[model samples]
Target: MNAPTVPVLQVHQLTKSVQLEDEVLHILESVELTINPSESVAIVGPSGSGKSTLLSLLAGLDQPSSGSIELMGKPFHDLSEDGRAAARAGTVGFVFQNFQLLPALTALENVMLPLELQGARDAEAKARHFMDEVGLGHRLNHQPGRLSGGEQQRVAIARAFATQPALLFADEPTGNLDSANSQKVEDLLFKLNAEFGTTLVLVTHDRELAKRCQRTLVLDNGTLVEAAHASTGA
Candidate 1:
């Protein structure tokens, strides 16, 4: 008998809501999902559909109000805040729609941030290499404000990859870029995935981007429904 494959991420009956003065706002309800190692999946939905919220839960950045979440085969709810942060540092990388680069840091410095957090030696060298891979070698010294939007995003991508995380979460990664720049960033993302065999969970409204993944999951009012299986040829 063969051993069973471990899921990289798992959520069971995940629910999140907030109590308001008037009524309760249910952001997510009874959401169940899983991602296996080396799989790429896209979560597609309109604004206010809880796509970002779901991503947060899966990444262990935010806790689900009710339900269990296991990341990298460990029960997430059982971990302390510091434990969760350490787990994320070891297992997850996140790219946000807003390109959350520090205004004070240069592209090189931004890429080095993750490695520094982990106390990795030779952080500067590794940061530069990743930045070069993202075609930002020339902009290494430029701060976020000095670089263009796409350039800033590439820096973010480089930073996300610097730690060589097992799973990568990207929320509307190309949402803020122009068409050409979007293509560049998209290509870089997929290239990294192919090279590293990284598990990907992406949230986006772009149909074209969603189709590129092996699976597409749709969220309607915080409930997940399978949209389509993996298909070749975009």
Candidate 2:
């Protein structure tokens, strides 16, 4: 008999709000979701719909004002900031729109940083392998400033996948790139996911990107409005 599947990510009654002056601005309200392992999911919504906020909370990068998030089976709300950081180590990877590469670090070094932090002795080899996978082996020595937007993003993708995390989160990963580069990045994301079986959760406004996911969640007015065709700009 097959065992019941345990969700890789779980969110129940997730809500987030902040105090602005004398007013309380609610950013998210009763958001609930569950994601199984190795599933590719997209989070999409209009501006100010809390897509990024939801991503942050799910990734344990930030805590929600009133909610609990279970990521890879650990309750984030129950952990301290340092505890959450410890939990995320080696298990979660992030790709960002800005590339987030260190200006002074070469592509190789930037990709190696996370592995080194995790005390992997083969950091160089792994970084090299992922760089090659992303078609940037020749650009290993190039600094972020010396690389084009697409190349830098490719490096970021390499960095994210080098750790072989169980879960990957990306926030508008191709937003800063041109259409050509965007397509390249989009391709790389699904390729890596297929190759690694990494559960992917992305927050993107790109309809094409959303369509590529196995499923999509539409966030509107701080709530999830389930849709059958999320890529249709629902």
Candidate 3:
């Protein structure tokens, strides 16, 4: 039989630090983690515990001060900015807490942007389909300012999925919403995950949302610890 495939993401001895005036502030220490393909995992921790830092590193949005990260069988540290961007274009999608949609662009335009960037010929049609999937069909022509927070987030989700990314990273995706809207977004997120088999890595404070994932990794002062199965609802 064939050997098991390597994980989609691997981090080894990752560390990060910054110089401040006269002292070096250590933000992360020897962080190590692995995320398999199509797996859903949550990173939960208090503010400033380096949860966002770890997510950025995993997504190739930022580099570690030491050690290495491998994604999709490529060494992340070895890739240049352009190369990393290309890699992400091919394999990763990110949903920000602020819904990062371009204010000037309509919802449909925002959702179509990535596909167009990738030179896909059917960008419009594909974007439309994903918008409908996220229950944003009626809001296609609306700009970010005109939509509700939940609607804006749904558009962001559609944009992220438009690329059919192998991995999805979400940073406090429901942070700005009320409970009802948060639940709605959460349901949509899992629905898309189930339908597309997209691996999920979420950084959140919501225990209920974290519980829905297959595994949860807790970060404390930048070091990682596996949470109990009960904590993860695994």
Candidate 4:
């Protein structure tokens, strides 16, 4: 008999709202979710459906108005902004829609930044390994300004995985790419994710990409629901 796996993320009664003049705008309401270790999950929804908001909250980038969020067994919703930052350090990785590379840094430097911040003595070596993993090893000397969008994004992916984070969150990772680049990045994303055995939670509008994950969660009416399968209609 095997022991039950501990969840990487747990949420309950999650809600977020803001005051708009005299009206209170509700972005999320009583959402419940759980993700086990090494699970690949995708959250998909239309624009303004709070998909990004939920991702932010889950990643500890923002706090919800009310709820409990346990990230990696820590009380994420209870932590202050700085506390959240400290908790995420070295434990979490992120990939944003816009490649958030420093313009002054070369591709290798960008990948090495996080490792250097964590005081990893062999930062350059680790960065090089991941850059090669993403097939961007040849572009290591190029700066973000010189690299193509696809190459820059591959650098971002390598940077995200360099620290070997236990969990990763990506928001619209392929949104800015063309169909061809999107496919390539998608393939690389899943390939490295599996190799590293990192738990993945991504927010994207691409249904095809979502289907590649183990589960697809749909954000509807300010809450989450499991996406129905079209093949079996289950």
User: What number of clashing residue pairs does each candidate have, in the order they appear?
Assistant: 0, 0, 0, 0
RMSD of 4: 2.4
**Model 1, span 9-107: residue lDDT tens:** 988899999899999999999988889988889999888999988888888778878999998889996577888887788589989889999999888
- How much lDDT does each candidate structure score? 0.88, 0.90, 0.90, 0.91
Query: For model 3, what is the alpha-carbon lDDT of residue 39?
Result: 89
Query: Ten consecutive residues with minimal summed lDDT in candidate 2?
Result: 225-234
Off by over 4 Å in 2: 230-234
Regions of model 4 farther than 4 Å from truth: 230-234
Return the top candidate by TM-score. 4
Off by over 4 Å in 3: 230-234
Q: Summarize candidate 3's per-residue lDDT along 159-213 as a digit string, tens digits.
A: 9999999999999999999899999998888889878989999999998899989
Residue-wise lDDT of candidate 4 within 47-166, one digit each (tens)? 999999999999988899999999887788989899999999988999999999999999999999999999999999999999999998788899999998888889999999999998
By lDDT, the best candidate is 4
Give the TM-scores of the predictions, in the order they appear.
0.94, 0.95, 0.96, 0.96
